[model samples]
Target: MKTGLREKLKWLRKPDSTPATADNTRATEPDRPGWFIPQKAESLLATPLRRQLMKIIWQRTSVSAALFAELYQTPVARFAVLAQQLPASEYHHHAYPGGLLDHTLEVMAFAAKLRQRHLLPAGAAPEDQAREAEAWTAGILYAALLHDAGKLAIDMEVTTGENQLWYPWQGAPAGPYRLKYRKGREYALHPVAGCLLATRILPDSALNWLAQYPELMASFLYCISGQYERAGVPGEVVQEADRASVAQYMGASAGSVLDNPQPSLAKQILTALRELMHTRYRLNNPQSGSDGWLTADALWLVSKATADNVRAWLLQQGVTSVPDSNIRLFDEMQSLGLIIPTTEGKAIWTCDIQATGGWSPGRPLTLLRVSPERIWPDADGRPPVFDGRVSPLSSVPEQPQACGDAPAMSPVDPGTGTGGDLLSELTLSLFSGTDDHTAPQASMTPPSGSEEKHIAGDGLLTVVPAETESQPPPVTEVNPPVPASITPPVAACSGQNFTDWLREGLLTRKILINDRLARVHMVEGMLFLVSPEIFKLYVQSTTGSTGDEWMLAQKAFQKLGLHHRGVNNINIHTCQIRGPRRNSRVKGYLLTSPEQIFGESIPEDNPYLSVLEEGSGTAT
Candidate 1:
């Protein structure tokens, strides 16, 4: 099958007439009409790197150039015309001229590689798989190519000749165009917008062919629409491939890109919170407008106030990526395990505060519950625990899930014995999205085998729910303060030191394991460290260095020969996260010897995580 395509396309292979150089020169030449030299799509894509990428893409198809051209090249050309010199992001990945095109092409190539490993129509018979293989491949390619095409529509204001407004839906510009990123643009809006512009980039023939396969078409649509959670395997393949491309450009690897860490954002947030708590925030005050109340078990911060202040603080500190919306900020905090969740797995809690001084809020206040230890790792630094009780009000009424079109299974609230409802109708009117806000929460019921368990070994906290109502629930430390004695006093940062620090942190409960936001996971009787993240955390903690320095630590760790390299000598390994609803993948480095970190007492393998065999077709 491959030979036939190669033979037919042999004549198409030819040397480039002009020497290849970076196309970014054209992007920055001039925004003026006189200097804006419009070029043909084919000519624009004639650069050596783009030509080579196209060749790789065609090779992955294993089809004749004529057939592949009609299927892929045509659409790519159309995309080039529209994307000409546009960047992928303002200040992030591929933020150069023609970066968007390069990133898209790279993603397509990477997706092609990943597609070979999966037999599409998932559980279909071999005959069916063979029959639908090409369609599935095309679907994956189309999904990857058009993944970020919506950026043209939503992120930028485009003007053609004579300052004429240009819309992507109106087709490629016939004359010179000027483009500028929109200020205060929603970072996530482009994904959905991409769906609308798909028809403009993709030919009807290709779309019709893709539409023939219902399952593939659905996934393709979902992916382009940015509903990855619903897109199934196809979405995952596109996401991973996209990550690989981004990682390559960002000077990281696929493994680290698997779960791209916001290197300084998390640290910045924590720092801001610490500063706010220390200076501006009024805690445990009986006054009605006090910033928060710190009880024995949890620190309850007023939701809106804290989010607003944190965002303002970060913005003032020159962190522009902080979410403008309070809901998104809350979600970010919860995802980072900075806040303790309610029984319904939500970040914001509706509680009534009754202070010992006979001062009480007349109405229920929306608050974020944070574990005390996360704020004050040293017990001596904490303020005296509050003497009053903070009881949750009755469960709020469930609202429609705004994030998705359909309603998912509502998790029952442990406090009310019913599904927790929408925050909008209650105090969180501004927050309108799915109620699945995950964070750490102490369960009232006994732990189930299926539930995530925290074991105290190597400094991990073994949190046992308090037996009495009077006693406070023990909090598990997420980011504990590193101790001086744990280090060997080498003073130099090295791989051994990183590992030693990790081991000591786990043992001392300075670093959390098996938590929602944890970077380390026990899988297949070995330790899986989420790359770049764990390394970034170590770098940030030890040297307080940022930006690409973690790569040094990663290289140092690789030299120790502690990690098992995967196919193509990939340092990152894939782990399947088996959840109650669906299964997902996590990429990291698996330790060659778990004993090196844990010694004789190895913790139980994370029940939710199972390492996937490299290049394996199956999840297990």
Candidate 2:
């Protein structure tokens, strides 16, 4: 190991010298100025819920778990001290007091449970599994436990009793620490923070054991660094556990994993809506309320407008598991408190709104009415109501045809039914990113951590509920840039995202690029990506997005005028297929440059493919 890694290993072992019990370590606790999690690390872990988590951890990795205690359980205790009292998220499941501890225990237990089914270091011989199982299990548990630790300091502000600022990377807070989610903290990379945090909590001995398994250690690091795609089975285990935990907590599943393939569908609906509200839709606008309108008494939003926007946004962000129906979308929103129940307890309402200025005639529209205070700001200007008396146009639907569980295209409300069932899941503005205090605004550049799958189990409050992931907490400043250089921005939908995606995919093994005559290749240090398939992928990612549809993306790449043509001026190439039956030609393009997208070495050329470049006849 290099000197720097050696120094880091030495530092990770530093906590082991102290007693694992908080009481024993209390006197020696570093005198720092931030509020601690408000409970001793040992005590918190000793709780019934956490004890059960330890039980699972022990069963999964008894040898390593024993070592955990032998090391004074000091590192584990340090994490608990920093994580106590803080909620895993501002809202959604487990967003209340002590949510972090609950969530941590849940994820650890879930990861262990999921691990029981996998033969990890997958494809390894049975003997190798027996030898490495405990170590692998321990690494996963540790990874799951610390996956979101970055949220501690990177996403939120931890303040001292005297209100002094404290960062978790500096080490565990000295005493009871208060958490204030930083405003506009959407840009911080909590996963990167988790990697930094692991330095403080992972003991050197544990590191040594884990590092011995190169594949296991690499996956472990990939997971901690927020690149789940590379983490493989271990990452999948963590993800599955996260999803299951979120489903269990948010009442999506009553602990029945087998109930639905999409156990977290309800959570997904809410999350999609939340993301739309955060980055795309406008609420409480005065002149033009394209998405919704909020007034002092209530928040009135166009039903289809909100639904379409939420669905489109979620799709663009790569959440493909969302339900396809607007009715289903409304049902989940109504179930999750994104919309209030009607007098008869349905999600949709029909009413006529006349312009307050009397410049326009009365118009009928389907709308979702919610509590005004839920999204309105007391300090800012309010929306003006229409002049006409807003009355329910019709009675609620009676499970008719045409729309599935949705009211007919028109509105209907029967005064007969009572307020049926109020939503149990009321999301505070935590996951949505902005509340009333932040006025509706236009789109800004995507945040720095766009590549990361947010999932806040609660994404912008949109994506996964079973994961109970929270949005990255607010950051006080721009985080130091990563050592890896980012690809410069290119024209939207110009196959630019595909290039970057392919590069990362190659590095992370998300895309297959090393096989013979692979669909994608690097030649002359430039990309030679397959046609149509690459275009299809880009299309799928931006399902509901406008402007950059499939054909448009293909055209955009063509317009870039970077793809190569052969000496015969052929952009498409035909290669001989060495088969008994026949030969074929596959169409692809040679993108301009590799350094343009990856900004790093390709590491190695694919030994199987011929290198192709523009204005060159060489096939080597």
Candidate 3:
């Protein structure tokens, strides 16, 4: 379908909609221009590759010029020049020598465009920005010029099966028989090698900085390797620009007809540019994970709800599909407030505090009065008065801890009972009669032993709704002076051994796979393996894994028992806790695979910490 600039702009204007068409097109085309472009590519093949590299470099601080020059060597350039001079066959897309050069130029052009957009004119040369722009231009240009540089050093031969070619870098024929060899065996490693070779030549060039910022370099190469998927928007632009340029030339030369409208191309260019902007912004202002940092939930409430209902209003506008996890938390000070409905409707909302201590079960909480100059205490001490909204309640019950026997706490299914509405019930819990209703209260503690790895231990301590009707006031004064020290089981593990580490890792985060093995991936610590038997048992008991395959595997593992067979060890490096996979040994053995478990650093936002007293008992 033909989409107009107005229609495309309409989607971009809405955050909830996310403009999938724009994003997808930006991700796929390489000839599209960008808001930032470092330099122009000398050739078509070079454009996509250069575009991809520029996208990557913009992710981090900055790139150096010395490092930029190193991406392409003379020999590689010579080869590309030769390739470009050759006549392309009907089946060969980029089979000529200069193909690499063509891609490199396009990437450079896109990057040049992007640089012009973000950086100021006064800082354009020799300075870091200039060097960054230059080096970025150079590196991408090099990646484009050399991605297929090895092709110049090889030859293609048509055979019975399919077209086969030989590559000098891989020492194998890139032909019909071996797709990997033809495409580039050690395909993932070529860009690295290319960068190294390019560096040797341009020792003082801008790209040498890439060695220091490897992720940026890697991200650039990865985009091309995925051909765009792995590459974020900036990277995608490189790809899109390269493709667009080639398609334009190819169609022009062949007199081939296109089924699409010309405006589609412009739409694609704009989308890629937007994505590039989004990616750079995210990299520049990453979510902070420091002490006194805002929790994701709290941040969401403050930013989205109270901040002029910007979030809800945006959501209603079909702009973004932000999940709850994207929310953040803050421990700063502000006027006391409660979340009450704006109207008599059952819907509840957060609002400023009109007075302290007036909470009712069914009645909706509401207060529109703004307290802009309210003083508040932060984690450190009295900072300044915060103009923002504070959480209605500082403490709320956390999700269930992973006690081996604790039944998974399942909220009513969204599809069932009033669409799983809990406004009335949750509101009652928040306000239950009180004079201190505006103050933050301690969250109900999870039962002790809820985090125990084995079920044989005493049953976990849990909070069932209090059966009695009478209760104390809900609110506690704001920033009530810091309390005396309280020992928490989780806190005690600061200097623990491997077993303790394993327990903590498993209990805190959801299970993840590493190298096909099942184990919990930690954010900043070593990966640990709970006994596979216990792991399996826990999964079955908690409904962590489902389906017939999982159920059948549970039965087999049950039968297998805890006895030491050939596979007793749960390699933390190889463990995986993903969904069902085929088992060659036993149809439903449910064994972990090597690819499933990639090491993940421990999460900064721990799920085990208690919310009641910032650093109270752990395993809440």
Candidate 4:
């Protein structure tokens, strides 16, 4: 029997119901295009992480931009539309307000990597195998992308920006939209929804091509319908990819056995810390009771206490598969740059933290001395250093710091649960996809391209303004305030704030203005902010959304009356910095007062900055 030819799929189980069909034709304009804040898919996909995934797809399938459009791009565009800002799960891995897009992109990447291993037409003639390779590759990518497509059907009531309840059966929702999860809704039935909506997104031409391969077609359909038993390799691959994706978010090895010594894990320790600081955990509480304490220059936490607290919180939130051991958890945290190391370069710091009347004799604590800006934007009033001495642990706890021992989820049995039904979770834990008896993954060789390596001990390679620490409530930049004055209450992404960040960067030594090609520098005790370079930094910090973002920032900066213009009626001044090859002009602002940013103790002028006088053309 031809797949998708059935009047109604057995899985969909709605003989009387019509399947949802989106207009596969691309929309020239979306319904209510700018209803809510629009997240441009092109921008979202252009991020460093997604860019790598797209590159992987192109490499694995040898897909050019044209070929990708013919096969995958159309549906991807549609998926992005319908699922605008829709999260993957309500309380799971990507439980954030808008995590669906990131999650979907991840699974597709995993599936693409998995697709490279298999020979399509598994046991067919060599000629047939060669003929269907691209088709097979396309099938896997579409299946992975569509795996969670049905999520919109049963899980939530999604509406476009205009308050229309757009249904997937009708096609991708017309325009701007948001989603709220359904209470007491059946979670697993979405696989059926995926089947109904798959055709709406997958172009008819691609389907016609896929129909030529029966085994591949059947397996792909079964996986879409949430039937792994029949999905065979496709289903298994999706299952593993899903688990691996979740593991990456959970900071756990993707899939590991309870008794096994080694496991494939996902690493997002820094993202996790970021999430905690933003949503759940609180840091630097000076009060008697708090999650952790913040000092003059560092954040201090009880080592075992924080580990236990994080583990318990993750488990409660349904991230059941995580680093089971405190040591492993600490390893990820330290590696992700989330925690500070001791003087001896150890994750666990032996420090005696004293808060008021209570003090631990000397316990093994975690000393995390991150920048103040990282945890809070406008935090003020630095507290004195802890009044205590370093001592040794006087006693061992009952479990000695609950490492991997939280109520961890067990590895899922693929055969036991239905793929689409959330009647109960399928339980694809850390060790689900890699069974010893399973067929080997497609390639053993690491691809020529690799992800950017991060030495969490080090920081971001790019110094964008948005990533800068210590943005407080904006205040008057009109007069230079002392460094100890107060945190301003400015919009974090504003141009004025960008200048403020430059000032703070100078103060904290986070930015190197003295270096050649630096955007901001001090010259003649006045703030010199390089024009386009500094603006680019500001745009990147605010939104990596558009190429034109900097133009807006430039306009915003001009609105701030900080720069002093010369008699030429130009606030921007050109300067000549000498290099071995030649001399070139760099344009920036000369702040009216250094006290506005540098405050009471302004630094001396940079001897390297040679400001060009009005009407001065070439450097002699």
Candidate 5:
């Protein structure tokens, strides 16, 4: 064997020097700063949750514990020490004491599971793949663990009890430390910052092993550096795993393997609305002000108030993924079929409100109209409907008649007793199997090292089952039939069709622009569509295409000649995203003319974004 491979084998076989006893190895108690003192790899892995996760990782690798210890455990120990009770975000997923560590371990396991589905070095021969399998697996695990390490370096300000600022380069803090997120931090800079600390967390031996494989090393660098658009399979697996961890922590299922699906954001929105209605929202109040009016046909909510409340409520409940902009939230709601759209397929409705008791707004108020049946499925559980009628000044566009449309409620007739029984039957039909209550958000507190098992079976820290371990029955075969009206029709697939669809979706607010989650942004008075993401979304929605099919769509779109080319005639352009604390670069395609996409009247340019000139930076 070559010296390098021989050395790696020797390193993997070396026995751990630390004792295996939990009491001796694990720092079961926190210090004065409420941070666990740095412990050995075995000690850090002593917790039930971490141990369970380590077992899953081992199962995925099918490797001996000694090999696993050298490759996985050592780096994870370093990461845990560096992470030290830091929350993943200010108020997002895994936002609690020691959340960063838990999230990282989860991602490592999840990524391992996801990695089993693929043959690495992408197009390599089977023999080559088999030979390099262990290297690729290690690369994936390292990539997953370090993916968010940059957040600790850049996004936060960590201080020791002596008021000393601690950097990740200095290694884990020598003593107790506290951290606070920097104000106005650039959202996209952490990935770039993470690249700086990769060498610190990963040992030199592992790095040297991975460096032998050029393609794997390149992909690993791209992934840890946060340029996922160029990272290929490694990037995709890590990102999917990260999303799954975040989804589960935020009380949602990570939908589908291989496909990057949007988490159940709509369900969370509806759940928030339901909670607010029960606790804080005042509906149909006569003597005092009301948040909304519930009528026989619809529930008309004040647009601005409803948006603000829902956004706040979701955030408080640990759903930090909610859009900051009301317009984006409204667009999401409408697109997800949670709210009835206006005649022009808009989310907001201009309406005049006049109560029977001579209470009326001075001018028309913008509102959101929701079908009552959506909120109150059981008639008996619903509050009394408004005595006064809610007349819509602007009518909603009629949808195509479908078998799934809820039977329209007839005029309430007390003598005949019609609507109640019908609504009860509809309630049973609509929500037969689903739970009415929202899944509890994961706890912010880290699981105790001493605990043998999770107390709550369905708690926030619930372990997501490995996909490869078992194949559940097909959802369509097992689950009850879903109504067709809820699922929107897929647009015809083509490059021209995609552009046309984009233009129309933007115009109609079905596709959002200039928001945090938005794929299309206005830059230099032209449209800057984030590459691969926008294309992947189009292909996924329309035809569920993967791999080369996505590339074909991009090439097809390029053939249209509507996009501005970068240096070396590259189709991708880099834009500098300037924020208060720092700046970051994003890769995307710049349209040649705003008029081509948005016609004459284009939206204002996103203030934070500026298109970089050709040759300004690397283009993917």
Candidate 6:
């Protein structure tokens, strides 16, 4: 083994270990952070050994449930049972004496918290707020308990002497070196292997169903396999639990597992996720003052896709059986609109199932072979047709017989869309006082087998009509920048936004997006959009002079943020006038529009743009 890994292993087994009892608190117990799910402490205590540990712990001192879970998992009985069967010392990490028991506790805690925050459900007292916590607790606990169950075949070692070599079994031999087990064989491959073992441990009824249905197992595997990744929620919980347990067993800090159990980690993850949610909110109704309907929709799609793909892959890989009740986790994400189908041409589906092999926590994966689908524009945008579709993409539909061929279509209520385009009217109703003129927005049609979907267009629904020449005599113009009267508020941007409008503008205008590049571009766009509100606020809050490259960026974002608070800040302007100190190597540009700038980019120009350059070399 490498010296670093060896040192790490040695560190994990250090002495001065704290007893695994719930009552003993770590002296450094601040607010235990990092995705904590509140579990039923009383319930956990009912499990035989855990129950005993709990009694032992409280007898000494009271501790938070989180702390109790951390300490309770330190007992030897849990992982030791599984480890006894594994002969290869190398696989020990997977079933290392107490690892499984420890991870299971942590996962349960985290899952419980998730359910509460997301309202995952707890039965009768339901609202969205209550449901998520239930789902999280159930899904995560199951995965945690069985995660490392397959590590029984691994070996263990306790070496001594200068040259560490020899075997534990009699025929295993002995030397000047006193080795407990052979080298080069460890718990490195336990997660994938454990998944296979899970099938056997589960009742045959459960096992047989999943065996026939790969998707069921895939969901479990996705959660377990991703335990090593740094960013995701599931992996973070598992890794932290594993670390906390090890830290108690050995006297050393198992920082690599959970690292610092700081509140900052929780805040950071929440902050990033919130930003993502905010950006989605603004994009859905740039000019519509709607709630986070669009953002909610997008998130739902992501969750669904993840769940579906995981289910599909697991079944394909032959991990078919799982608890029936637990199957609802996959279903809920779909119903809540957490996962979405791939946009047409957005991604290519690869037939290669081996791509996900050798899976581990924190490992990066490329979900190839996913079919792409085009983004559809909302009703308020363009294209009059909203109901059942029957036409080809390139062809425009004829006017509806009911509405007739009137170019002056009725104005839609400004902002009433919800998560599924549910409540757009409340936000965008301009003429509420006079109900007769307002027209209702059309509803979306379900997908038919073979429609050619299109990319969601930039939020420009239509060009406003110029005031007719024959209207009443013009009123005197106000010299001051502020408008004399505020127009009624329209459905416009909401939620704190972070999109980098400059990057998005560049990409959308300059890049020729095919299927493959679109999704990648969108993900990049999402990241940029959820980054910071500094850009939009900067532009709407100021004007030129100090304006230069940075100012132009700020100005562009004001539009993307959809600054429709009132009539005074109706539009956004962006221009690269001049930097105070200019270098020819760095050129600049500006943009101005009616909506807030959600995101932007400055990618290298394409060959087509290169051909449009005015000068051959210098300014000849």
Candidate 4's residue-wise lDDT over 242-352, tens digit each?
A: 765665555343232111122212223333444444444444333333445666666665554455445544432224344545666666566555566555555654444
| Candidate with better TM-score, 2 vs 4 | 2
Q: Compared with the true structure, what per-residue lDDT tens digits does model 6 show for residues 1-620? A: 32331232233342332222222112232243221111222323344333333343333223345433432233222332332223221211222223344344433433333222232222335543232332243334446555555443233443323344322122111212121332334435656555554433333332333333233344556655544442234444444444333222221221211211212211221222232222222222222111212221221112222232333222211122211111243222222232232343212111111112321212112221111111222223211221221111322222112212212222122111233221223212211232211111111111233122111124222222333222212222111111111111110122222243233422222111211111111211122121112332222222111112222353433444443221233232111112246512211112222133422323321121111122233321
Clashes of 1: 7
Judge candidate 2 at residue 509 and give its lDDT.
Answer: 36
Q: What is the lDDT of residue 251 in candidate 4?
A: 39
Question: What lDDT tens digits, residue by residue, belong to model 3 across residues 1-620?
Answer: 75432233333332221111111111222233221111112342244333333334333214343322223333233333233333221112332333344444433443434333343222345454543443344444444444444333332222212344433333212222211112223434433344333432222323334443454566556543444455443354454344433443222111111111112212222222222222211111122211111221222122211221222222211112112111110000110121222233212233332212232222212222222121111223222222232344322322222213222222212112221123224222322232111111111122334232222112222232333222223422211111112112123222222234334334322222222223332211222233333333232222212112222332333343322222333211122222255311101112222122233323332222111211232211
Is 5 or 6 the stronger prediction by lDDT?
A: 5
lDDT of 1 by residue, 221-273 (tens): 99999998798888878876776565444422212211122233444466567
RMSD of each: 21.3, 15.6, 27.2, 24.3, 21.7, 28.4
Which stretches in model 5 have alpha-carbon errors above 4 Å? 1-8, 11-43, 254-620
lDDT of 4 at 219: 85
- Per-candidate TM vs. native? 0.45, 0.52, 0.23, 0.40, 0.46, 0.24
Clashes of each: 7, 27, 112, 29, 1, 105
In terms of TM-score, how similar is model 6 to the real structure? 0.24
Candidates 3 and 6 compared by TM-score, better number:
6
Off by over 4 Å in 2: 1-37, 71-74, 123-126, 256-276, 284-289, 305-364, 375-620
What are the runs in model 3 whose C-alpha is more than 4 Å off? 1-115, 118-131, 147-166, 170-207, 212-215, 221-234, 252-620
Q: Write candidate 2's Cα lDDT for 1-620 as tens digits.
A: 32332343344443444333343224333355333445577667765445545655565554454454743255667788777667776534455556676677667766766677688778899978977777788778888878888888676777766667877665555555667666557644886678887767776667776888899999999999888878988887776566545544543432232111222444455555444444445543333334555554676667655555555544433344444455666676665566786777777776655445443223555678866544432324234543333455665543212233432221111111212121111111111222111111111112234221121111121222232222222212111111112211233355565555556555433344533324565545557666545554444433332222544566556655566555655554422222346533334566656666556545355443455333453454
Candidate 4 wrongly placed segments (more than 4 Å): 1-35, 38-44, 172-176, 253-620
lDDT of 6 at 410: 26
Residue 489 in model 4: shift from native, Å?
A: 55
